[model samples]
Target: MADTAGDSCQNLREESARAVDNAKQLQDSAAAFISRSGTEEQSLRQRALAAESTIRKLRSSLDASVRRGTVDVGVAEKIEEELCKAGSIITDGDVASFLPSIDHGTFLKMFLGPINVRATRKDVQLKVKEEYNRYRDNTSFLFLIFPSALLLLRSWLWNGCFPVLAVQLYQAWLLFLYTSLALRENILRVNGSDIRPWWIYHHYCAMLMALVSLTWEIKGEPNCAHKQKGVQLFLAWAMMQGVAMLLQNRYQRQRLYTRIALGKAKRMDVVWGETAGVEGQLWLLYPILFILQGFEAYIGLSLLKTALVGVVSEWQVIVCGILLVVMAAGNFINTVETLMSKSRFKAKMKRSKSKQELDQGLPPCNSRLK
Candidate 1:
């Protein structure tokens, strides 16, 4: 019995020893696995950081190349020369005498002279001139009629003769005028002309409409709901048309200006180093204009909404806000392009002037000669 008991104890001790050894082996394996995983993770992080650094260096190099190589240095020099010449010409004459000549007709004659049909055989130039003339004529007509129509509307409304109809008609007329002006401006831009007058007219019309609307709202009784709804619809339609006009104007103007500048440079036997900058400037202006249009749209929409629903919704406000942001971003890009082009152009001009001075065996002037 004693021997049998001793044998059982020995078997149990052997079994326990085997179990402890297996546990130790498993623990060692687990430790090894953890150490290897940590090392691999650290290596991946290092590699990622190295890759990012290389990308940054590459991006910087690319930016530098674009700024120095892609930019038109020659064009910038030419613009500088032209500006100098213009400044001297203007300064030589009596300032007071030249002030009156700053009118649209005179300004156009001088500035457009370089790229006139006589200088270049470009179809675009002719188209631009035609468009500009049309805009001028239309604007003149609007100016002549708007005031008289407003007076008539005012009198009719005061007399309470179909007051709602009179108000609606007046609003319709204003809408038509603004819409026409916006469209003409866009067309002029497409033809490569700056429609500054149209821009001014649109703003003026908007202001006038707002005032008139406010006045009518205050003075007249809320009797003609149907006519008021019609007026609201007209305003909305006009606003939509205006936005479309602005978009078309922005894109067409950019193309037209770019082409006109190029044509001018080619005709004058001059390279504009600042073409990129000018383009960038236009890009910047575009976004700003877009934002402005968005704001205008928002205002018009808000007015219409209030008139219709008697309340403005959060969603509408959010939509307007988003549009404004997008417009601003577009403008920022445009501005950057213009500034860069201008800088490059100026640099090219300086280099050309320096070369000229050296060739002539003359000292470089510190200031540009007026």
Candidate 2:
């Protein structure tokens, strides 16, 4: 009996000791976390102060230069170069000049509700960018796979008409998708990402399309096939977009990595709206993209025609159709501009190569024929 009692007391003592040790450890961890957070906050404040100081100094210098009636070209060039470091796709000047109204903050507040989503450090920024790209890739895959499922339901399972609830759910998803995309793009921009304006605007149009689609009446009572035309066309367009997103993610990613390796692209460079093309991919990519744009236009025009011809006159249909047509036109114009720039770049490279070869072919000035 004595031994048993003694054993129980020892066990209790040991457990008490362990509990005390764990409590001490927890207290230490709390202190360390508090210290670490304080340090981080201090660091961030210092950085902000430093940036403000530098900006003030620059402003003073610029003011002085302006008072003298001539700013030094070297100083101006240096400022531009420093600003350009934000991105190859967008000059800081361009971003500053483009939309002075409301700006990124308004959109951020509108979509994400005043959250601080921008990462400050370089490593954090890169990680944010990587995750953003992955988000895009995953969504592209989803769109690709999801639409096929919908197509199957429409054609085989549902007998050529999508369920009303299913259509509503799909439209809701589209709204969420576009809202997420736009929010992320805005955050990325704040983090010094150089995405193009058109890409951001494209998401805006997509969001509008999705919003209007929610109100669109999906029916088969009156005209049967005619009533379902817009939804059918929209599903088809979604499929095309999915395919384009997949190809762009694949080819553009590979090209971006190669360019980074060659030091031809900035580390921060990303594929926004498919400006430059990889070798041998121009033929494969551009044609498909162009075809997709044309098809988008066709869908838009069809919807508009249906409304005009009294096939199905809904305000939702008209609004969605206009948005689609505008988006398609914007995409086509941007693509053509990209192609033209690519052509110019290629021509310049060829001319430079020819010049180099001609120079090499000539005999050295000091070389005498023996």
Candidate 3:
């Protein structure tokens, strides 16, 4: 009976040990599950934070757009899509495991959304055309008249040799004639006006002027100080003019690209209708001209200083110096104004994009996000 009791007690102890082992296995499984769940929760929280930040950035962008007075519906939709996707990644179980595929181009498109939308508008096209026309007319007039007046004034003031004055006058006249011709070509291109022989005449004359200027620079004899200075000025002017023409061509090409990209018109249509060449010419011309003016200013200042220290008259030096200063100031102002306008336009575009995003229920992004 005692032996039976001892065996029964030993069996009871074995059963208790088995129970403890089963409990430990259950506890281990629970601990592992809890650890995995905690990690997933942490990951989801991180995703939520990221999504919230993106949404906020999008919202800010939208607000900027409203101030710019332009609407971009497509951009708004895109922002909304991004927001939804991001939100899903944060809240949805399976989706949370995957990262959103974002890229620089995608972000850039979003940032420039307003510009893309506005560029597609018919009214915007019309406005751009009108502005181009106005610019062309003003530029043509200035190019035709200003150089002629400057030459005439120089001739009158300098009392320089007849040959020098004659050469300068002839060059000025040729420049004016070519500019008029270029303007006509440009107008024809824009209005679908008939092309005329005058267009060819202007192109030929411009090429002739360029060749003549180059030849004169190489072959002309400078017998006097005045003659030497005049030749130097003329050479500088000619070189700058040629550079301007090249730049103008590039500008026109860029403009054509811009128009096509904006879907305002076809490249062929614009090319056929407008003398994009003139636009290119101006683009090349202005910066070079500005630089030339700056150089001229420095030259004038140097001349003035030399005159003061030497036998030359102070009055003549002062007058030339003043003219150079005036030209430099004018060029500087024009350059600055142009830069400012471009900057303002870019800012407006940014604001417009932001506004569109905001309208679509997205938060604006920080300006620094881009």
lDDT values, one for every candidate: 0.46, 0.77, 0.52
Error of 3 at 60 (Å): 28
Better of 2 and 3 by TM-score: 2
Best-first order by lDDT = 2, 3, 1
Which predicted model would earn the best TM-score?
A: 2
Worst 10 residues of 3 by lDDT: 95-104
What does the lDDT come to for candidate 1?
0.46
Worst 10-residue lDDT window for candidate 2 reads 91-100
Model 2, 161-264: lDDT tens digits are 77788888999999999998888877777766667789889999999999988888887675768988778877887898898888788787888888777645
The lowest-lDDT stretch of 10 consecutive residues in candidate 1 is: 266-275
TM-score, every prediction: 0.29, 0.72, 0.34
Distance from true position, residue 186, model 3, in Å?
15
Give the clashing pairs for model 2. Answer: none
The best candidate by lDDT is 2
- CA lDDT, candidate 3, residue 62: 70
For residues 1-370, write the lDDT of model 1, one tens digit per residue: 9999999999999999999999999999999999998797567556545644554565565557557876355554464455544443332222212122223333334435433222122354455555554554454445445444544554565543234455555555655655544543443333333333434343445535534553454223444433343343333444444443433444544554565555432111111111222444556544544455555455445445654564333243334333334433443454456567667977987987897778578544553453
